[model samples]
Target: MLGELAEKGVRVTVEAEELLKSREADLELIVKLIGLQKPLISKEDVESLLKPPELRPVEVVPAAAFAPLAKEFSSDIRLNHTLDVTGKSRTRGEVENFISYFRNRYERLSRMLRRNGTVQTDLADVRKRLNERVRVVVLISDKKETKKGNLLFEVEDMTGSFKVVVSQSRYNEKILDKARGVILDDVVAITGKVLEPYIIAEEIEWPDLPVVREKSRSENDVATAYLSDIHFGSRYFLEKKLQSFVEWLHGRGEARELAGKVKYLVIAGDVVDGIGVYPNQEKELLVKDIHQQYAMFDDFIASLPDYIEVIAAPGNHDAVRRGEPQPALGKDLVSSDITLVGNPSSLSLEGVKHLVYHGTSIDSMISSIPGTAYAHPEKVMVEYLKRRHLSPIYGGNLIIPENIDYMVIDEPPDVFHCGHVHKNGYVQYRNTLVINSGTFQDRTDFQVKQGHVPTPALVPVYEMKHGRLRTLDFNY
Candidate 1:
């Protein structure tokens, strides 16, 4: 009945009518009304009425229907016209009234900006510099109360350190109570004035960063292989092939170079088969449970030598934020050998600064640059170094903090490693050796569906001696 009325250019109301009883009665009435209102009723309008709503409707008419009407109405009318109050031009008068209201509001803002010099303030260099404030999320380590009731907080980031002083006297008593409860490693955002070099925090906000368990360190020449995004819970996870790779690392025929030399192992992220990941994803999952998926990963990491240092950084598929440059898992979950670090982390490997970032964005960048993406992911990584960002854009697959500097290379790194696209590549960037370690898992359902044939590869070992580096690829 509603569809029939909609087709005949009749306004649909909530109350049911007695004239439209069944489909046959509505169809007859609709045909009659269409003939009478031929100027208003269109075939396309009837088709739209018959088709089901794209999204489920509620008690009220869906908002989607009004969007097109609103757009059309807005386009035809200007928002600064004078109103014509006469009833002879009622339709035009109503549109003019709305336009007048919009124009009045805009003019009010314009007048305020002119009177207060807000527009000029934006252009003034001194005012711009004075208003230059950066909001930072810091993990408050230590806090002390000053004589004047100001709270001094010390915070640390990957790059360097800074201090935040909050004037406790200005805040309400309840706010002070909440501020006192701040704990160690509690991620908090501080907004304040930058006094030349230091930040004088005006306000503080809280965010959650899970407490991680710590692992013991080992003294050995043991090299740990760090790789991310295996997608093991998916049908793409090659258990047999991964098993062969691990066994080869342990000491298989003709592959003994990796046995004792590989003292550490890390699976950075995407260890599970996620639900609702993409279209037809449910059909591609081999293991569905996330906990069971981690258990499998634990078993795989455990199979490595006990002396090996195993660490993991959560990926988009992992039970953490699907952001770039994620932090390694804290000490809580896995064994001591397996340490979890942030997604993009820096470590001193044999006295060489090695920065690791899972190269997920390299695909888009590679595709954009001519003859870059397919030929070498490592070369693309070097491009990121030039930009000085681990992940540049805000919300593309990887989440990054507002004030955190992922690109600041204060001290040049000797080696850089990343893995996400499952393609193995290497390149020399300035003095840094950039490596994109290929995956150990064989191609799965996603690879087949997406038509991505990955190069199944073993680890590439890098040895630094006498200020020179030697890279060796060990195939299993």
Candidate 2:
């Protein structure tokens, strides 16, 4: 019915959408609404326009299911080894290991930049050409702005370090704009004129993904539903709406037809709001016991439809290590039949590759990168793809500095799914579908202070074969 209204040039709020699905509302009113010609219909609009012939008792629907009714679900889903960090974590946090970690990251990302047909020279030998144009790949060690508003970056390769400056007056407007988004520790190729000590940058090239990669389509017509930032134990958790979503998966009203085609469900992260995550966090939590919170999560997963294969990862709020390449949720945390992987895990479903990250680094990217905010995380995600690495800024998040930089996006997944900001955003960049599934938890006091508006209970369903997307709001 929401889609029907959308076709007729009307958008409905989730609350208004819920009323339309209730016994109090009817489809005939949709025709009346179209006649009214209001582009957006809020809940109050429905209440004012909708008048029953007489007052009667309303049928109160159950808020949640007592148990998950699993059905026979058989789908082609396999976990890929390259991205999962489960038992392969190797790091001592020593200075020597940290050196190895950054060097390894540089090698991988610099190789990607070299593939762009630019002959990269080491910083030690870049000056041999003298005043000529030269290309060099280096990690940004420090950055500052000159009094004249020129951008100066102290960058270095393994061999040596040098200063590269992008003058606001001398360089093109595009180069200055791109330089504004550059953060520390970013491995990128800078092409410029070697002027004595400084390299006057003219062009900066990141290890971005190719624009023409084939977007793999599934042979089957199954769709995948994504849920994230559930925060099950939080006081702000939208239990009723989540319950409505679950019931919808089991053939509830309105968008029931699309529900049947959903073969896989991915929960990006924040399965439970962990203890002591922040100051005064305990006061906002309903279930203070952490294990009991997981118990509730286990019960919820156990209740899911059998045909919908569920794969989940941890978030900063989960009972896992707060690091970029976090391991999977411990077996002791869950007992339900589901695939448990690391924070950022890769998998293949219906022949399409999916990179599932809890998206903890989104905050860092948003703060460091210009033109990024909590509202449009898909844009920030594109920066990750452009840089060919997640968490490019080292101190942005708690990274363990493992020998291997698991944060590097070595292989581009066909679909990238993430959720941490609690705001839903979807965009397809360079044939890769990027989706931030949003959150199931409602706005909190912290979010209010941060000016973050969460699109709670708004879920996205993706069609595997056709790349079609449909969103269902369960904030009813």
Give the runs in model 2 whose Cα sits over 4 Å from its true position.
1-73
Looking at model 2, the pairs that clash are 68-303, 70-306, 71-306, 73-307
Per-candidate TM vs. native? Answer: 0.50, 0.84
User: Across residues 1-476, which tens digit of lDDT does each residue of candidate 2 receive?
Assistant: 66677677888888988887655424687778877677778888888777666778899987543232223335888888777788988887899879999998999999998884768889999779788999999999999989988999999998999999999874378899889989999999999999978999999988899978988887777789998999989999888888888888887667555777788899999999989998999999999999999998988877767778889899999998887789999989987888898978889898889988888889889888889999998898889899988889998989988888888888888999999989999998998999999988989999999888989999999888888988898876
Residue-wise C-alpha lDDT for candidate 1, range 294-404, written one tens digit per residue: 777778877764545555556566665454445455343444454456666666544555666667667656654444654467777766665444543334344433222
How does each model score on lDDT?
A: 0.53, 0.86
